[model samples]
Target chain A: MKYKAKVFVTLRPSVLDPAGTAVQSALTQMSYNVESVRIGKYVEMVLDATDESEASDRLHQACDQLLANPVIENYRFELVEAL
Target chain B: MKYKAKVFVTLRPSVLDPAGTAVQSALTQMSYNVESVRIGKYVEMVLDATDESEASDRLHQACDQLLANPVIENYRFELVEAL
Candidate 1:
């Protein structure tokens, strides 16, 4: 079976995010009344698996092992069967 | 009312993404069998709005005016009422 995973990688709340701050500043300069801006990584991938459960497990493993840095980053993913 | 917006910004298919390429190579090195990997930006923000439709409009405007470069990047967003 084929599955698609949408992974979101974000910095831990306690960590400083310079990129986010820069973006916020830019938005403010552009006259957008936004309170805050956060920048993170979104990854989409298709993978082979035996079943939905197996695909979920593999996606979690991928996020933990490669997609996100455990110390400073956190990740969440959603998986769906792909055509 | 308060609303939350999840924005995804990705390079157009025709554009070159070196960062995506580097991550794809890293994933391959880690022994993950993946067809391809695409990396993009994810942004989350909370804003004040009169209703869902207004929130959606503001999110779209934000993306078009600042969050994404329409020439090379494309964006999509989802909005939900915040508790």
Candidate 2:
């Protein structure tokens, strides 16, 4: 079976996010009334697995090992069976 | 009311994504059996608006003008009431 995962990797809340801050200020200056903005990486990947549980395990491993930097960033993912 | 929005901006399917290709290859090399990988930007924003409709409108405008490049990228967002 093939599984598709959508992974969202974001900076830890305590960490400084200059890019997010810049976007927030830009939106405010544009009169958008935006209070805050936090930007992160969204990754979509397709992988092979024997079953849903195995797929989930692989996705988590991939995120932890390669996709996210655990020290400064937090990560989460949703997995679904691919057609 | 304050509204929170999670926006995802991705490259069009027809567009070539070298970074994605690199990631896919790297994952496969790591014995992940990954077929494809695509990366994009995920942004979370908090904004003030009178109502849901108004908040939605503002978010759409923000995405169009700043959050995404419509020519080569596609964007979608989910809006929810902020506490």
Candidate 3:
């Protein structure tokens, strides 16, 4: 079966996101009473696994090993659907 | 008025994404007959602009200036409803 996943990887709260900060500054200057600004990554992957459990496990491993940097970022994955 | 924008910044197809490539390799090892994999950044910005045109123009400027690295990344923005 093929499984589709949406992974969101973001810098941890303690880490500095210069890109996000710069955008926030620009918004302020543009006269926007901004609520909040966050920048993160969205990754979509289509994988072939035996079952949902296996797919989930493998996807988690991928996220830990490559999709995100555990040292400075946190990651989450949503198994969208089976194909 | 306040306007919201969702910016998606992605590496041009030409640039190599080591992180995404690594994940693809891991997925193959996991026996996932992968379809495709792409990784990109999603940014949500709330801006205060006089109108839609101004908001869009400013957002475009922001994307070119800092939200994305034109050299390696391409960015697209969706203007959400006004607030």
Candidate 4:
């Protein structure tokens, strides 16, 4: 079976996100009533696997190995069986 | 009321994502059996609003004006009431 994963990589709450701060300031200049902004990554990947467990393992491995920096970022995923 | 919005900005189906391609190739080299990869942005914003409708409107405007390029990307958001 093929599984599709939607992975989200976000900076930890304790980590400082300069990019997000910059964007927030820019948005403020534009008069948007936003108090804070943070940016993260969303990744979609398709993997060939035998079942949900296998796909889940692979997705977690991918996130740990390549998709996120564990020291400062947190990653989560949603997996769905795909046709 | 305080609102938190999680916004997703993604490339349209027709747009090429070169960065995702590079990562896919790298993962393949590391022995991941992946078929496709696409990457996008996840934005978290905190807004001050009286209700959900106002928060939703402000979030959409922010996305359309600065967070996403409508010609080549699509954006969606989920808003939650926050303390």
Better of 1 and 3 by lDDT: 1
Tens digit per residue, CA lDDT, model 4, A23-59: 9999999988788999999998999998999999988
lDDT of all predictions, in order shown?
A: 0.85, 0.94, 0.80, 0.93
> Can you list each candidate's DockQ?
0.72, 0.92, 0.44, 0.88
Minimal lDDT window, size 10, model 3 chain A: A27-36
lDDT of model 4, residue A12: 100
Model 1: colliding residue pairs: none
Model 1 chain B: weakest 10-residue lDDT segment is B28-37
For model 4, residues B1-83, the per-residue Cα lDDT tens digits are: 99989999999999999989999999999998999999999999999888999888888888889999999999999999987
Question: Model 3 over residues A2-77: C-alpha lDDT tens digits?
Answer: 8898787888888888878876877677655565577989897888777888889888888887778999988888
Tens-place lDDT digits, model 3, residues B1-83: 88888788888989988877776777777765677787889887777777889888888887887778999999888997664
2 or 3, greater by lDDT = 2
What TM-score number comes out for model 3? 0.65
Docking class of 4: high
Ranking by lDDT: 2, 4, 1, 3
Query: What CAPRI class is candidate 2?
Result: high
Candidate 2: list runs displaced more than 4 Å: none
Residues B1-83, candidate 1, lDDT per residue (tens digit)? 88878899999999988887887788778776666678899998877778888878878888998889999999998888778
Interface RMSD for model 3 amounts to 2.9
TM-score of chain B of 3: 0.89
What lDDT, from 0 to 1, does candidate 1 have? 0.85
Highest-TM-score candidate? 2
